[model samples]
Target: MALDSYDLYVVIILVVAVAAYFAKNQFISKPESTGFLSNDSNGGTNSRNILETLQKNNKNALLVYGSQTGTAEDYSNKMSRELSSRFGLKTMVADFADYDWDNFGDIKDDILVFFILATYGEGEPTDNAIEFIEFLDNEADTLSSLRFTVFGLGNSTYEFYNAIGRKVDLKLEEKGAERFAEYGEGDDGKGTLDEDFLSWKDGVFDSLRNNLNFEEKELKYEPSLKIIERDELTTEDKQVSLGEPNKKYINTSVGTDLSKGPFDHTHPYLAPITKIKELFNSKERSCVHVEFDISDSNLKYSTGDHLAVWPQNSNENIEIFLKAFDLNDKKDNVIELKALDSTYHIPFPTPITYEAIIRHHLEISGPVSRQFFLSIAAFAPNEETKTKLTKIANDKSKYAEEITLKKYNIADALLYLSSGEPWTKVPFEFLIENIQHLTPRYYSISSSSMREKSNINITAVVESEIEKDKRIVSGVVTNLLKDIEINKNKSGDKPLVTYDLKGPRSKFENFKLPVHVRRSTFKLPSSSKTPIILVGPGTGVAPLRGFIRERITQLENDVNVGPSLLFYGCRNENEDYLYKDEWKEYSKKLGENFEIVTAFSRADPSKKVYVQHKILENSAKINEFINNGAIIYVCGDAAHMARDVQQAFIKIISNERKIDLEKAADLVRSLKVQNRYQEDVW
Candidate 1:
């Protein structure tokens, strides 16, 4: 059969296209980024090398991090530094959400990659890692050339441990990506996160050395930053930060020009405290409900969201830390910290004073780790102190018994090790390098956004205990809050702890502190008609209060609302029944739609009861709601209450549905997968 000339040409074109497709599969194009980006010390002013096209970069390694709350970020930066310092590899650290992986297939065998990812909230990726997780989940571009390893940070208490890390590893392998080392996992539950990281890192270094013939170098301390003391400038200078969180907050309290900027992690709104009242009627323990006015700031928070309160180190802790480092004399010296390495930057904006850093920006009271102590033991004051420090660091059992069990912070430990002698030999640079930045404490919002959008409420119990020395040990954030509340409610009673709450040279002149709202996945059901069951014991009632308040608001607005059941437990009805009067009012308004199943552990000492026990007493009604498609919520202690509540639900389902324990557990797992079961536990 004779074919037309056009048909023959089409047939030839098809043959050429098929051949080209096979050739392309055999040799995919490499990335366009190849030039090495220089550091600040290297005298080149270029942007981040990782952001530059990857294939064009001469560096053989790239570290990408999916961090929430900065731990993974810290790990990623450390990896970048170590890779460059030891292996002679030009390395760069990048945020997981920062780039598109359209060029993912271009990774070559010689170029290694690393992922330091944190699994947040029940096997879920962090908010920042959401897009990248979806990209990895949906895309199937073959990366036969790629080589990588992963280190996952997770809490072992959760059901799906290190799910993101495991899923990503499997997906990458399926796409033909090879591993350089076995997958690493760090568990916060075992209190071995630091040890796990160190152990995994050592193994990775060995693997890299064996595979790439990488030569190791002596562990020399390289300053990622350079500090400049400004004798000409005072801390009052306009350009100086003075421990203010951001540029807008530099003169917020003093100058009228300083107005509230965008509310974020760096720029917290100095929301004023409006009201404070103690909920518990006991002197040994105190629980207070404090309110904040955010009307002036453009901050918006919904029910179940979290409010982060930026805290200052207690005055006593600050003084002790300064004395340990012998920095008390030069506390007011204004200094600027500049980045010396491209991958490194000061955690906070600088030109801040030593006093400000110590008082408001550093965590001086937190427990010290063994690895951190060993890193600075070489600069100890005397032989005796150095020997003790080294022993504590080297002997794990001794470290746990003597250091960890005592809960001695860096200042406390150093003072004990030095026998109260100030360690003047240790450099100030070493102290700054070792101490971590102060992190804000997050409290669940207790007020309904629907009831009062401009105001925020939180309930916190002051954490104070008398030690053997009769000295009080208090939480860094909660004690400061107690001080503020004392100043507000002056009931002729002095605070259990004191803070230099007038922060940064009295710039925070009033009781006001820095604050920001952290959005949470723990939220009320979108529909008001969705039957919801919540278990919140102690301060866990914080978010559940907001949930109930919202439902009442819905009832007020004439919106159809459904039945809501709350299980709350406390020590005694007369002593710590938090918001007792308000619950009565809510009951009167909602009638049968709302019910409070209470458990007072102290009310009946013979057979102490918990929220889960109360749950058992009302299992039939609870199961009815579950069968009617109710969503379940739990908040409070992850180690105890949350787990107990989960177990209680499994039992109820097994009994009501007449199924086996394992089957009921599977159903509960499915509910979690579908977001019908939610938790906000610490």
Candidate 2:
């Protein structure tokens, strides 16, 4: 058909417009995905299908981690590096939350899977592993072709230690999956987690060598990450992260409402410290009572929930770490980190500075691990220092005396070893790989949600340990809270430690803290009429206080409440007695129904009185309450006090029921199973 001049012009115009639209869409930047790498690029789209990811990436080994505080993830990465570098295996690390479990049976027999699971509170899997655990319980398909091994990280103090790990191992075998190695467990309660892991790893490698005919190569340090120093980007650059947790906080201005929905471990709310006061009167010891305002945000918490506070490293520790690593000069220089291996992932967001990494990302002030010493010895400043480090690492007694007993962190150990010489030869990537990412510290909520619905209260004792040489080892979060207490109260005296209370770019200025609420099963009965016997000594009284307050609030609301008993212990009434006057007020509110048994250990210098002694003193009453369907709640030191309290309860039951000790123990175990006896011990 013949076209006129106007028709021809219209056709050309339409073609030009279409081309312009395509070019604009191509140039626009897309949102970055948070998925990890299965190959050279991130497996964002395919991360949900584990079998496909493994087949597409050509990986023979997969390390899946279910971590709560990043320990399991770190262990998985360590194992992945070792497998890749030492055994020449293609490996990839996967988070339990990222993958689908339906493809487990579809994975080829040649691929090996490693389950690095950490058991959380009360025989539960971690938050990320919850879905996977549910899937394992409900899945009908048998994973007969799967070959796997399990390593669990847990504290032995709990009754269900490494429960998730054991369950996974047993379930996998039940589903016809083959186990290539014996199940391994690490005990943090005994402080032997590092040594246990090393021993277990040796056994696993032996099994691999014998069964799979795998050959081991000479061990060498191979960095999984590539560090790129961005000289052009300064700390002042808007794109750079100077301790900001995520990209959304990169250029966020002060006073902006950054609180969105779905606050959890990954995202935190910048809450303001509404109130602060000292609970102790002693000069040597201090306890702080802090209140955080959650009214402005969508955060909600119950009476016995936990509050997770994300703290930053103090300036003093930051400087020491930077100086020890010879990064003081380049601390402020912006840098970008990229994983060299497809399996590895950068721990934190990149375009960050060394100072920010030290201050906010890596745990620089924790006790140095023997394995870490061995790993970093090759990069020591000189031969003498290397030899010294190697000797200390190899000798258990020497390591205990010099590193553990002295409470030396990485910086402290390095400085003492080299006589203040910087470890310049050590690669930054090695440090990043070896050191663990700083995790949040959880504190028991000490306020009743009924009374103060929008405010969360925390009662924490500032923990400080004095070494043999009189060096003070400070608890990172507690000291940070102390600093906040001092700064807020305008106390002229210097704090035990200093922190940049004005957080990244002053976003956390004016006494603000990065915090989130973690739901806890520890709670009072749904009915106010249910009696509760609380045994808590020292800071263990925190949640107990919440229980008491909840009762008081109920009383004020004209609700009938049952009898309440609190067994509390401390040094003396004049010193470390927490909430002394407040307890009296609470007693007034519930006269004849409330009672408190005090155990002042230091009141009588010759004969110490403790909570267990008081428990025995009220044995008949406790037994009576138990018979009346009262719940027993214990919170305190998990190692000694909790065990002692439990034993005391068993004794009381033995005497009350005229039964044997074993029978009484069974009764207590039944109480636990029935949820009548609860523990919030650490």
Candidate 3:
């Protein structure tokens, strides 16, 4: 109370020093705690417009995506939503396509960039994301101030699996961008994309909370669907919108690159199925002969080509899928799809019914993966069922025994594992989000383009098998073809069960099936009179048939036809040897120029023989044909028969020329390089 003025001043200085220290720590300091950095309201600027607002409010975020088929776009959207919903941060999903590097270096250091990249086509950049990748390769200095995280989607079967996403992660790190959380890669081949993504996003959110000093919010699924009911129509007519899409969007530009075109998983060309016939009377396997007419179309293909068939979801399976998703009542609801790329289109009738989506869009043929089992496990009706699902998801051996190895599709697997409780509680969006789109099945083009410019022929053995556990699995496209053939034979007397081969969208309706030409390297010699040898088994004789037809047509025009030798085989000659009548016509014109040797493994009980055995039997003539510069072609099973035939050729060359095995193998390799030895095997 009686203190002097000097004592009072000393007390004031101490108080001022404490206040300055507290203010500095609160405003300008970094926290020691590790996790998602808290949002710096002042530094996290997003775009130019966001930056102006940020100068007033705070910083913003950046959304980046490297999508293979638009899945990453969906994920990026999800991330943007989470950033806004949980952190109260302003966010916008940016396509890597539209991003520029001019001011990237000048961006605030606290700006968050989220990357959702999907690996594709042996780790090659996706068509839409390629431009962005090029920018990254050149603009290392621009990203030095940025903070980012990456999640890659990929299949493991490919050698360079997830290389695109992994490469981007490395490049970003090299450019001095700091990570928000550990950048991760998800394997779609193992079906861990969803789980891996879910776990990674949670870590990212946690990091954001701690590292950025942002407050955490509860995580919840925000419904993206808008449901509307039409009173004029039945209950099935109620439309559900996944997300609002631009209805007036036009598709005017057409893709020119046939090989890498948009004719794969997302969008498929509904090529016509022109001609189909049964090749065998009695066998475990059914040989399907089909010719697709491509004369009026701009599609061009060559011999030794493969036709890609865009298959439909079986009606029964579609119904099952609808029931599973609890969308059975609204099966006919119409919706349009919107994608960032022209190559990625809606995989159905444009603005089509929901039934069309179930029937033609989703891939319902394959076995369900464990990740799917885990995702839906929470929706299980009981605790016991949930535990079982969790176990299956965690244990590969159990999953194999109970799901994959058992070869169970979604419906059957759910029914069996869940004790037949109807799985109608799962959302339609979940199904659409999880299941992959149906892809086209490739068929070897059996007909030579030189012989029939208007028609492209294909030969396929309809695949069907019964699992050990008594589940019937049918090949999707082949069965679709068979059903189409049966309906055509009925002459419209009855309604089709699965399909009308000549469906409404099928433009080549006059022809039996939809087909497009695929260019390939398999072809006959350019010389009209060049001697040739053909070795094919089963329906593999398809292209060789085209070659023979070409020779016959040329001979009819008085062109010189050289010696033609064929070694064909099947289970039995009377059963599965294809094109019996056509071969007769070919023989008539070619005479000694045509040689047909048939090997029927089941025709004789004494011993079984194949085309390779037949070739060995006639080694002398084969050698003569080979020495005369004859082109050799082999078509069949690539994993076995083609390999066996190749080895047999080596043996023949070794013995005939009296050379060692190495020398004989070298000769074969040289012939292959020179195009004298060619193969078209599946």
Candidate 4:
């Protein structure tokens, strides 16, 4: 029997894993399928054998994660690394969705369990963790023998901050699970997620050491994988992957890997940009309306779903990183990496090139973590460079000023300190171990699934600004999107952003990019008769547009509709009012049933009118709608607008119902519990 290309790739990876496992202290090639590589990590028949696997591997700690966008999974892996290296505790990372709940309570008493969960949209569990949450909710086992700790990852901007994590903590306690340490919460809203985790882990370690009789060792550098450069095979070789994302995209001469496969985050569809146009009239900034042709792909999305755009790093940036590391000469040289330790998991496939690793796998743009800075300082070109890095790492005050305040990423920091010097002494494996993986950026789908089932639309405001240092700070995905809009429109003008439009091997030459659909809880009411009140400011109107478009389709089908009000806020109506003509068309179809209230803050009014002010102005009508079972939805900036809108609603309820502040708050909470007040805030 002959093996397919993907199968061959998998076998090669398995072989690497086995070889690495056998090497023990030596660096060898070993591969293990990681959760960060996909949307769902529970794929095989052995998924339910978590307990058996733990015992077989002699692991004492099992880190289970419920993640939507890989944050929790990444944290889980980090915990695994720390546990295995520093505490001398054998650990295994597992997806919550993989194990069966029926046997969840039967796990051995010797093993410690850790839950690193992220509360997603509207306080809902992630798609993969849904079944697990439900099982925990339904099962009646006491779980008396279970010992666990939980750390929640959530945005404080949402009403239910860390709701899933809170639920799990309470439920586990109720089921008699002993908690060794106080549970922690990491807030993404304040941009202190990493700092919060690092802080919490120290307390957790103290508790673990006290409870489990554990000893902490001095932190030392441990190499998990060894990198071997192959000079024989060049970039032109058939099997060489020059930044191709997956096995199906390897571009072998035998034939195309036309198999559609699963259109999940792991295996994305190369969706073509069917149509794109600038939405606003302003020239200084850009907000593009893009349409993707998904007819040939198996990616299905609802009206309020999100589209994950896999972006490519700029060629100039990749080159700068290569040169900084003194690897520009051997950019295409094939390298095989093998894990030296059984606990360490390879993030990506082995036998890839330096260019592919730098361009495709690693996140080269983000600001450096304090721990990462400490790790890389040891490999600095000179003692002076090392001293400077060590100073920044040791002095918390200086770190906040130099790294955080200045927003210096790895490349910028390295280039600034070691000017004209290549840090060639840094091991390739160390770089791979420290740098984070490049993940996809998600955008709200702005087109109705019904109006254009095969075509998905994305509305994004490009984030590009000239920093104080005269350096351009830009978003990777949004800049890529702007480039696509430029290519489609044939705008000969100087672009606000630029990109290497020709992707790996020109796979994305025709403005095609890898994409996948992520179903969101932010959706329109199932019934057309259900009234909806939408509050979306700026590009937050992305999902609201989809809702209104669906309502338009329903009206076209001659179905009865209810009151659908949209409160959209922007700086000015002339410069950035979005979908103006389309709203007018919708008004014609459903005369009194549809209305769009525009709040133009910069229309040169006597006062700056905002979305919350508009909501308050129509408080009487809003309260009436709420009394009549209307569903209220809020989107956009979660920190300010969403918070203000919620307060405005609370005030309306207080005045309308003639209740006290406490009672009004309870009423609002009830609405959220009933799913009447939903939010899709960022």
Candidate 5:
């Protein structure tokens, strides 16, 4: 029988779809054997019997991930697994940075490309995905045949929220790529990054099934790599297994030459911990105040800025990581790595020991992923164990409620789920390949450059708690800083927690922390002619203090000064209030130009009020400041405090200016786009 043009077109499309599926599975299955490029080494080969038809059809679905931390990469891998196991689709999760774009235009029309892009650092592309971002921005025309979907991760509090995701979506469209589903955006600020992704992804999967006529494939256990034992090693040999590369590398060494500009992603300056104090007297919940000395470095900053601190895992956590990866015996073994591309920078310099890897390279303490569970299934000691691991990995609701929602890290999760099998069998290479590199954390620069140009100050609340599930949790950076403080403050006797006091790569000697300044748009009115209202509670006062100090310095230097008002809040006046005496000097210089209100939530017999209440009381003056071109700024917690303060501002505009709710909202929105209403919330 002769075929018509319409029939021929349909046949071609089906052929292309099948070919794409096979190509995807061929790329994703196994590691070196598959030629698939990924940062993760846990590449498992799916069972041939389960996916024979899909493999034979040669249909490939491309999954690309732009990950900053490992979350996006992990999610991409999960999607790839879902495609292969559930819908009988052959899929590969391509690392966006590593994927070649030259032939994107030639992709099979039936092939579906999934993009998991994460926004990092003021909407900038992640360090590993920078090239991919630049490519899409510059050579978007190359994606004419691509059928794609994108999911972006970002916090709404930032000015450029999910900017990379939005830009990628727009750029791809401009380049002629057809989107299969609506581009998805997940807000980390709203604590719904996971839910948003899951919800959006369901629709995407449904679309793929309808478009391609995909059928479900039963899942089976697949182990990426194997853990084999080497015999004939004694205790002494095991002690030296990590080799000599690690012995010479001290954590503080990375920043030894900060005076000379060797500072980069891996190497950081070990600035001295000049000062440390508790923001509150209460032992239950206390914030740590810290100061870093940069008198010798050329690092300079303004009033509103951020300081990125390079941190190391605590020795206890390091030990836990080594044990979990089954590398404790080879604690001193040396290792090296080569990046496939120039853009693939090692998290840090390698040729180091297991201890260094544990302390610096691996993000060993994060929550476990389904992929992790699936990867470890084959390594289970017995059949029952394998079934249990597989169940945990495959069951989304069970995994979420028992694992992710409970905030369980790998070690605790393994212990709870595995019945204390001791996780001493997981391989070291698997960890280095699967887990993400530790990234630097940013803190608001609480000190003003005008007040102390050569110095930087930071405030953080130490997070240590026993949750409802009875799991102990600690903030990685804050706890590390606290340990440093304790070590420095120790007297003649040995300190309680011995953290190898010197960091890996010798980057931090004398327990000084590594830090670099990151600039912020949340700045003072450049002219100083605009009156300003500042509302901040607790550590939120950090940047506001900078503004106050900057304005004070400007007035002293014969610069024009404007009226300034600050509503600062804390638990008590005598304890948690920061920059107390400095505010007095600041107020004296400005006179009526400066107005300060203090709210002590735990001080009075009437149980404590907050800064939002204080704003309502002084609604008249606030209205006057607003009318006279006042720029309002709020800094602190976005979850509750920032929103409450925002609501208070809306109320002030409505009650004091006697405007309708809608008009008041418009005024706030206008101020927002004008940069007059700024927030530096985390």
Candidate 6:
């Protein structure tokens, strides 16, 4: 129909353009999409099918981890590497959310599976493991030949400690899976998780050798990853990840608006810190009340939700880690990482620099594991260093005295062991494999969502402890927050530690932090008419503040709010009492409906008074509230304070009701069953 040559040429060009667009959309190859900077899978074709994945990789052992805060995943990786290196087993680490469990029972009898699961709050499965738990509970096939082992990571402070892990082990056995080793539980409450894991791992290895006929081979240094220097690339290269969380950030324009929807643990929004203030008056300690602006983002949080703040390692710690590994000179040099095993995945995005990996990826500030010492001993600079590392790794008391008690990180331990000599012989791949990826820190939201729908508030106490050797042990996120407060306010207070507040490419220049909200079951009653009792001490009062604020909002709205009682404790009235003035204002608004009882632990030097003591002192009132159908909420230190408070309540109930201790405990259990008693302890 085209009569003229010019018209025909234009028509052909348009036709080719349309064809190219369709081709790019349907046929052109693209990099596989992954969870934000995650390397959980190797991008294999059979990644979604557990049985097919194992068969395709020819793996004899599979380790599946259900992790909420990366600990379980870290342990799974460690075990996987040890299995491959020490026993010549073909092992693969799998995330619970990555694969389908429908065909899990179809795996061969030769392969052994290990479940490294962590129990989340209130004995619930982790976010990633919920589906897998449901599948095991509701739909599963029996396979008498399948063999497995389970090790649970939990805090003993919770009533249902290791509940998920125990359930998984029991379910597997009920589904006709053979148990190759005894179930193991690691207690974080006692600060003995590492030792417990090591002890259980030794027993598992023994069982493998004795029963499974797996020979224990001499441990050899076999790197699972290959690191290549990307000399052609620079920090300015768009392909490089200079602490950018994911490829999207690296590819997007600097001025692009990225704070959009679907923000979660993997993808976080960079929210600006709109307000910051010091909450404590003590020189020795510092607590900060900080607020974040999320009006421009799609992030929403309830009053009792948690905010996960992703923090970067301090520049000092990053430099020390690089120097220890002899990577200081090439801190900014771009490098590409490749996994040696097809089933193994590199933990972070590359081409990244040593500095970025240390600052944004690795947990460089965490304590050095004894197993790490044993793993890297083969690459020690000298025989003396190797022997010392081996001895410490084997001896519990010596390891605790030298490493645990001193709180020495990898860099500090290396420097001390080598007498200030850098560990130049250690492979960078080994370090990546041994150290865990940095996880986000969670804080209770201290602001009511109804009052401030778009602004999230959190209160935290900056943690800094001096070891016996005068080495300062600082909390990673808290100190980062402290530095942010100092920098933002332009205050005269000297920061205990410094951080690169500007962030990568100056994206976080104006007091911005990467944050995501995690929904929690810890919440107030559905109706404002339900009476409540809040027990919080120190930073534990964070959520209690939110509860009070919610009631205040309801009252302001002329809603019939119920009576509320709060038990607050601190070191002293003039020192570390958090939100002291705010309480007075809240009292004015709520009037007789709200009451606060204070306990100053250090007010009297001879005796240490705490919130539990105050609870006992107000036994009559507490008993009355209980009788009036008041819900009790406890938030604070789970190791001691929360436990003591619960005991005091039990004592009050026993005295008030003229019941035996067992009967009072049973009543408390019944309350918990009815969701009248809740705890948000750490």
Query: How many backbone clashes does every candidate have?
Result: 8, 0, 26, 6, 30, 0
lDDT (10s digit) by residue, model 4, range 214-302: 88886666676787877887777756667666756774447654436567666778888989898889888789999999888667889
Candidate achieving the largest TM-score: 6
Winner of 1 and 3 under TM-score: 1
My TM-score estimates for the predictions, one after another, are: 0.89, 0.92, 0.64, 0.89, 0.76, 0.93
Which lDDT value does model 3 have at 205? 83
> lDDT of each prediction vs. the true structure?
0.79, 0.86, 0.66, 0.81, 0.69, 0.88
By lDDT, highest first, what's the ranking?
A: 6, 2, 4, 1, 5, 3
- Candidate 5 error regions (>4 Å): 1-70, 73-113, 119-143, 156-167, 198-258, 262-267, 338-348, 369-371, 385-401, 404-406, 467-471, 491-498, 604-608
Stretches of candidate 4 exceeding 4 Å from the true structure: 1-48, 98-102, 251-261, 341-345
| Window of ten residues with lowest summed lDDT in model 1 | 31-40
TM-score, candidate number 6: 0.93
Instruction: Please list the residue runs of candidate 3 whose C-alpha ends up more than 4 Å from where it truly belongs after superposition.
Output: 1-274, 335-351, 466-471, 491-497, 500-514, 604-606, 618-628, 658-676
Model 4 reaches what TM-score against the true structure?
Answer: 0.89
| Model 4: lDDT of residue 308 | 91
The candidate scoring highest on lDDT is 6
Candidates, ranked, TM-score: 6, 2, 4, 1, 5, 3
User: Model 1, 388-432: lDDT tens per residue?
Assistant: 989888888888888888878888888888898888877665566
Off by over 4 Å in 6: 1-43, 253-257, 468-470
Q: After superposition, how far is residue 103 of candidate 5 from its true place, in Å?
A: 10
Q: Residue-wise lDDT of candidate 6 within 226-259, one digit each (tens)? A: 9999999999988788887665667786776687
The model with the greater lDDT, 5 or 6, is: 6
lDDT of 2 by residue, 555-659 (tens): 999999999999999999899999999999999999977999999999999999999999999989999999999999999898788888999999999999999
